[model samples]
Target: MIELRGVHKAFGANQVLRGVDLVVPRGESMVVIGGSGTGKSVALKCILGLVHPDAGTILVDGQDVTGTDRESFLARFGMLFQGGALFDSLSVWQNVAFRLQRGAQRRSPVQAREIAVEKLRRVGLKPEVADLYPAELSGGMQKRVGLARAIADDPEIIFFDEPTTGLDPIMAGVINELIREIVVEMGATAMTITHDMTSVRAIADNVAMLHDGVIKWTGPVARMDASGDPYLDQFIHGRAEGPIEAVR
Candidate 1:
């Protein structure tokens, strides 16, 4: 459903995402794993059209997304950022329904609130929290709210960035399961970027490891342990002495 070919992006003298190529089939979930500053987030942003690539093409459903009419192009997918990115001023329901409540594409307030509440339920949030502000909720609750918002419109594609960060292990596990369930229920293509192995195991059908601005390994989740790639092994095991370099 999504494909990237010869993707390249750079910041001044430093190059990131050197000729990155990736593909995600329809109704499949792909997780891209990499260490910090390896252009994983940049690649996601490029797909979202938040960042423009200096070179290469990104295609969604066989059409090139680069230079496409972004308004219509963006309506086809949903994204949840790592930080929850909620508005401090808006209530939970408002935050979840932001897209449906504003811009040229607007849903009625009553309808929007109903959709938001339904999505909140899908993400395991109760109806009572709908009126609460972001500040009133815990970090995990905020993440759930963000996830709820991402799926509010039920887009054909979803992108999650560090969906399980900053939560207790148990809560993270809950969120991971919720993500998997939602994706399966919606039959949507998913691309997630996270370092959490639990999230990887819970949500991914295929795994791809990014290293040195390129994909170092790609395989089914079941084959990860026996993939025989030193990079994947080093990352999955969290070993400090493997092929991955540690800067002083």
Candidate 2:
């Protein structure tokens, strides 16, 4: 569903991405794993057209993203940010129904609220919680709300940015399971960027390791451990001693 070929991006003197090539198939989950500053997020932004690449092309369903209309291009995607990124001023329902209440798919306020409640339920949130504010919810609840918003539009492509960042292990597991189930249920193409090995294992069908501004390794998640690539091994195993330099 998505492809990036020979992509390159740099900020002044600091080069972040160089020749990043990736493919994400329809109705499948692709996880990009890398240490901090490896340009995983930049690659995502490039695909979304948030950060224009200096070189190469990004294609979505065979259409170059550069040529696609912005409003309609973005309409097909949903994103769950690393931080819950909810609007504190808006009530929970409003936040979830954000996209529903605006743009090409705009709905009546009442209709938007109803869909918001339904999506909240799908993410294991109670209807009553919809009236509360984001600040009132716990970290786990906030993440769930963010998830409900992501799927509110029934988006064709979903991008998960560090989905399990702030939660405890159990809550992280819950979010991971929710993401996995929702992607399967919606049959949506998913691309996630995370450093958490546990999350990668739970959410990824295929894995790509980005190191030194390029894809160092790529393959099925099932083959991650024995793929015999030093970078992938060092990353998945969390070893201080290996090809990856530990930030000190």
Candidate 3:
């Protein structure tokens, strides 16, 4: 569903992505794993058009997204940001229904709220919690709300950035399971970038290891352990010694 070829992006003297080539098949969960400053997030932003590539091409469903209509292009996507990124002024239901209440696909407030509440339930949040503000909830609850919002419009593609960050192991596991279940139920194409091995194991059908602004490895999750790539080994095992530089 998504493909990138020779994608390059640089910021001043720092070159983040030298030549990133990746493909996420339709209805599959592909998780990009890499160490910090390895351009995982930059790669994602490039596809989302938040960061323009200096060269190369990005195609969604075999069509170039470069000059596509922004509104229509974005309507097919849903994203869960690294942090909850909820609007402080909005209640939980309002935040989840944010997309439904605006733009070309706008819906009535009642309809939006009902959809929001249903999504919240899908992510394991009670309907009453939708009336509460973000600040009133715990970190895990906020993440669930974010998940609810991402799926609110039933997007065809979903991007999850650091889905398991800032949560206890148990909560992280819960969130990971929820992500996997939702993706399967919705049959949406998913691309996730995370350093969390547990999250990758839980949510990915395929894994791609990004290092030095390029994909060092890409394969099914089942074959990851036997892939025999030093970079992939170093990452999945959290080793200090390997081909990857630890200081970076």
Candidate 4:
């Protein structure tokens, strides 16, 4: 239920997003894949209104994102940051219930904790773990905690920024599975920015390859391998020689 039409953004002389066009259908997972500095994150930030585009439009369910009531508009979305991004001083439950304890979704402390425990359970964390701090958890556990926080408010849309970063292959696999399951379970519209092909394969219903600040290809995940686009092919194969120039 999100669409970007000819979106363009640039910082001084450095053009980050150049006429990006993308669409994310409701209740489906859309993964945007690209190498570093290809504007994947900039596109996301534009959609979220964190960065205003210099040209074109971003619409969510048909309304331009720039005109919405900031708080209410943002309440409809949840985010799982690239890093775990947990507060060192906060307990696990507190972190999970962060959104629930403030703004429009405010809940009583007890109610928030109850929901936090339930969300933690969904992410495979025990209630006892809620009393512990982020430093006490493994990277995998920390990511799970971030996932729990993302869904704690039962948002209609979720944004995952490099969901499988900084984890081992096995841990990354677990996180990917969790992301897929959670999106399906919540029926939430998901847009994820990640270069991780494993994450793309596991979590995407559709894939969009961002290269040179634009979408090089967009199609169903099933059609990705056969899409025959040089940019996407190079990215998915991690090829050193292709249209995408690898830095020396």
Ranking by lDDT: 2, 3, 4, 1
Better lDDT candidate (1, 2):
2
lDDT of 4 by residue, 98-191 (tens): 9999986599999999999999999999999999999999988999999999999999999999999899999999899999998998999999
Model 1 scores what on Cα lDDT?
Answer: 0.92
TM-score for candidate 4, residues paired by index = 0.97
Per-residue lDDT for 163-235 in model 2, tens only? 9998999999999999999999999999999999999999999999999999999899999999999999998
Residue 90 lDDT in candidate 4? 99
Judged by lDDT against the true structure, how good is candidate 3? Answer: 0.95
| Model 2 lDDT at residue 64 | 98
RMSD of each: 1.2, 1.0, 0.7, 1.1
lDDT of 3 by residue, 1-248 (tens): 99999999999999999999999999999999999888999999999999999999999999999979988999999999888899999999999999999998899999999999999999999999999999999999999999999999999999999999999999999999999999999999999999999999999999999999899999999999999999999999999998988897
Residue 157 in model 2: lDDT: 99
Q: Which model is ahead, 3 or 4, in terms of TM-score? A: 3
Backbone clashes for every candidate come to 0, 0, 0, 0
Residue pairs with backbone atoms closer than 3 Å in model 2 (clashes): none
Better of 2 and 4 by lDDT: 2
Q: Over 4 Å off in model 1, which ranges?
A: 103-105
